[model samples]
Target: MKAGLSLVACVLVAGGLGAAQDYSVVLPTVDVEGISEQDFTKGYVAPSNVEVNKNGLSIKETPQSIEAVDVQKNRNYGTNDLSSILEGNSGVDASYDTRGDGIKIRGFSVDGGDIYRDGVRDSGQIRRSTANIERVEILKGPASILYGRSQGGGVINLVSKKANFSPLYKLSARAGSWDRYGGMVDVNHVISDTFAVRLTGDYEQGKSWRDGVKYRNKMISPSFVVTNQDGTVSFEAQYTYDDAWRVPDRNPEKSVYDAMGISYNKGFAHNGDFVKDTLHFLRTELNAELVHDINLKWIAGYRKASQDFDNFFAGTYDVNTRMLTQNYAAQQTDNTTLSSTVLLNREFEGERVGHKVSFGYDYSIEKREPRLKYQRGFTASIDPFASSSSWNSARYDRVSTHNKHKAITHGVFIDDLITFDERYHLLIGGRYDWYEFKSTDINQNSRSYKDGAFSPRIGVLYDITPEHTLYASYSKSFAPYGGNGWVGVSTTTNDIQNLAKKQTNEQYEVGLKSEWANKRFMSTVAVYEIRHKNNRYNPDSNDPYLWAQRDEKSRGIELNLLGELAKGVYMRSSVGYMSAKTSGDEVYGYRNGLELENTTHWQGNVFLRYAYNDLWYLEGGVTAYSKRYHYVYNDAAKSAKGAHLPGFVRVDMSAGYKFSKHASMTLAVNNLFDKEYWRSSSRPGDRRSFMSTFVYEF
Candidate 1:
């Protein structure tokens, strides 16, 4: 693949070099803050400038559906973690399962392996701390060209806080219902004109609505930077360590309404719950201006993490006896990840055209070891209303080594954006990746497999005006099979045999982006169709082993509106509708066009904030979703029709007051109406939790 790319590069460069060089202009860059602070972040909207794309084209010139949010601003609007941050964006639904954070984009669930930090892939089940985050970007549609081997749903890019050459200090404390309490410290010091350092830390402890569920967590991040006065060269190092002990939340159960025609034990806690996790990561980077029109940058990162869990909320239910039978399970993991990347960016000018070119290579190595154990007799059964729901792990003698695996991936990608007189933009990019996986079973024997893919993307953007643009794009994406689906880890042969090929998907999208009132308002609407292959499922073949199939499809429309709505008023809202279904051959006698499980056909949200005075403000939001199916339909078998989750609407409200120039207080109420809504099949959302925060900055 490397040799083939080199040949292709030679031809592209040779062909373009023949053109006469007769112009000079400033180089385009991917600096999210380059556009003036007010334009980049004001009101409730963030800038169109993004660093996720290799080319620094604004969102209007990217020819794709995209969303971004300013963490600080969203914090006032009840945003937390990647999922909540995306609530104001179209076609995104965030949820939490026994795992950690999960998200659905355009009818596709993005696996943990597809999440990214900065420009590198992450291999840990992260809960996502906001202490070190500045902003996040959701790059919609096919993004493999920039992200390497990944799902077709797109990638979530987090931009961490950077050290600034100035003095900054902030302190904040928060307390809320369910005994929630936390505090944060953020400090930045300019030791010298050429060197600066920043440290951010947070600590929290809380009890949940569920009985016996409690959590304690702490995180500390320190970043340092060194640069010459000329700003032509710089070096940075960032480090973080997080520790947490949490009582796992109870899982959702079959609502009594389904069986007894009434809600019973609907929000009951059903777990012996415990989970402990720790993570450490270090990232180093270097940036240099190599020539008058060329630059270089590189990043090296390492991460180590572990999780220990015992007693979760998984059990079997006996409807007739109105009883629950339970089991005690314990699990743990030890993992290490190493990655590095080097990128070169250059700019050239022609009489009426220009180019922004980028080339990069990245490699990653990951290793994991896991242990599992179970005690079947610990908690044999619990009466539906039993008061004693305890399990005894001391009775279990031996822990088993279930599985351990490692993976290595190498990728090389190149991107180029050709600007024609600054009106029409043509972008092209592609990447080649080679991935290998090896896993070991309890018997100490291991198996290995290898696969690769070539992802390509191209788009065109036309500017009707500086604030209005129209564009279209088509991209290719693929994900290697045998991925554990948890942090891009390795999968064992017992889980997926052969694993010879990868699932592939292609996307075609067209959209319009517009802005008004000097960047104070922005709106975007996009229509897209995605055709996916290798979405395997056995067609109810009663055989001991079944082969995978490859046909699934989805189409959708997304709309996002943000920025100022009226005088001293700001609003952010989004809506999405999609039809995702199985195609071609029937599965388990289901119709070829049955809707996929857990996918909603309609989802939308709106949040608005109004500034009453320099010292007072108010914000409120509403989130809604249409019915979602929980199972696949047996279309040919009328007796096995699928069931759907009823649609729901939720509301939240907040108010704030600035008592002084350096101090402010805010109060927020979630589930303002105390609506009893389920986030998934069995997990009900928190009901009317109140939070109060006080912040001081200098």
Candidate 2:
């Protein structure tokens, strides 16, 4: 990690010097007129163009619900992690769990394959860093037509900062409560008229308010691009190295603690509980204008990662005795993935109609190997309130199992947009995927399966007026018998039998997109329903190996508002109401009609920024969610009245001062009122904290 940091620093210094030497000779200025000033500086405003849809479509043109997060602007409020960024978005729920950041969109968990970088799948298991991320785009509802198999809820695409023909050099440093401090550097240099290079790096270390928790992260991304003077053809390459280490915190169940008359503030993690992850990523892309007004693009990416996980967690508690059962587990895993995409797009105009068409082919292969060790027994019981030292006495057995899993997927898709005059637009697309999964155990036993599915999408929009559009759409998605990436499919006979059934999802949606204040502000209101069939689940608690299939559904309404609300005031806000429940029969009849776990009925967020003057600004935001259940079967007898995680509201504020055009500073306070709440399974949200950041630009 140290060597990587030093290398990035050296490159930045050398590049900065070279840029300074050529700064005056090659730099040029041009006059501009009639451009809205808010378009350049409004942080809360949404971008007009989005890349998640493959086809070049403006946000207002897409029939489905979508949202984007401006990472640069969010930094003012100390929002750095992906989980925090999504938690404030509409119809999305995010939290930290034992396995790292866990996210759910519209009440469905986002599979590992659903997260993307520059429109390519990223299968790494580590918590992602935002140092090189410029913005995040989310497409809500089934996206299998373009992205292949995934959860029906949505997909998140992180757009990385790339080299451009713009000269820029920036340095930023931040510090906050909980011993948190970090520094970042972004440097972009135009080597010549046809080439440019960019480097971004950051190092962060912090101690958490939770016991026995500390974290450190190091990340560096360097990229370069080559293009013609006319920009008709271009090629780019980028590489990233990221290393992260942190103590894992597995807090005691809040409801269990209350029933046992114990405090839930403390975690069950021992001092030695820790997780370390390292990732290496490489990508290359090519784009060109073809004959007959067609465009061609090809992108390829590769990722390798290593993870070390060691933790001690609580299983159950005896209410009368105040005793807790502890278990020790450890594992090391390696993951690798290679993926590529080739796409062609063209548009033509006819006498009374216009058409735009896009087609693409995608291929990917992923592999994982994990070795496990664990110790679980009655002797591991301990006092609920015991100190961390008391839990250190537990021992882990030798390696129990070594397993390898691999998945290969191929997909072909095409989409077309038809326009009638200038008032009506229609979109139609379809995708066919072939997926294969294989698993092998140390005992020389292997199991494999193959599956295929076809997904279709259709939508139509009518121009209610020049500023408002009304639209409706339907889409479908599917997941193979075996899951993707590290969450490999089970090879057991019973499990395979239950999962063999085709697992599929279908969604219906309607929405209205409206532009206000001359396109300076925008709002979207959408209503959607998604039904999941043949959902796999564990049937018997005592027999963890047993599996079954069932059906589930989620219906919701969402509203998102972004951009300048007034003269000097900018606002971003969202509100969503969803009902996610099991719809079909289950092995345990009582489980039917139950609400999905880790989902809330109501969620909303509002953030506002007021530029009092050219030198000073004030910002504040509020995020709130209703009560959520940790388990699907949260009955009165199974869980105590106060066992569920209660709903809570949190407030955050920031103040910024611009000393000059070259430098600025921001002071932010998160969780302003010090609200204590549980965010996920046995995990508590951060307490009130303060952060200050300073930035310099050249």
* TM-score of each model, in listed order: 0.87, 0.90
Clashes of each: 2, 0
Off by over 4 Å in 2: 1-42, 259-265, 319-322, 375-379, 482-487, 495-497, 539-544, 632-642
**Can you tell me which runs of candidate 1 are displaced by over 4 Å?**
1-43, 73-80, 256-272, 374-379, 389-401, 482-499, 536-548, 584-591, 632-641
lDDT of 1: 0.70
Q: Local error of candidate 2 at 83, Å?
A: 1.1
lDDT of 2 at 45: 65
The window of 10 residues in a row where model 2 has the poorest summed lDDT is 25-34
**lDDT tens digits, residue span 1-698, model 1:** 49535634553343233223322222112243342111212336656577677554567768788887667655543345566666525677665554456677776777456666666666555466555667777888778787776667777877776676656688888888888888888887889977888899988888877666678878899988876555566677889888877777654355543553324323334454577778788887766665556666667889887878776454556788876665556778877888887777888999999998889888888887777775444555556454535433232336755677787889899988899989899989889999887877677677777779999989898888988888889999887762224322233334454334567889999999999798888999999998877655444422212444546788999998888878878888888888888775543434567776667888888888887456778888888888866653343564345666777888988888878877888898888998876666655666778888888888
lDDT of 2 by residue, 1-698 (tens): 37435534553443344333321211111001011211224457677767787776678878899998777666555666678777757788876765556778888877466888888777656677676777788999989999888878888888877776767788999999888999998888989988999999999898878767788989999988876555555678889988888887765566666666755556667767888888888988766655445666678899887888887764578777778776677888888888888788888899989888989888888898888775335236777687877765555758866889898999999998899988999999899999888988768678887889999999999999999999999999987763322435676565566667666889999999999999889999999999988877665433444667778899999999998888988889999999998867555556777787778888889989898466887888999988876563444444322245788899988888888878888898989999988787577788898989898888
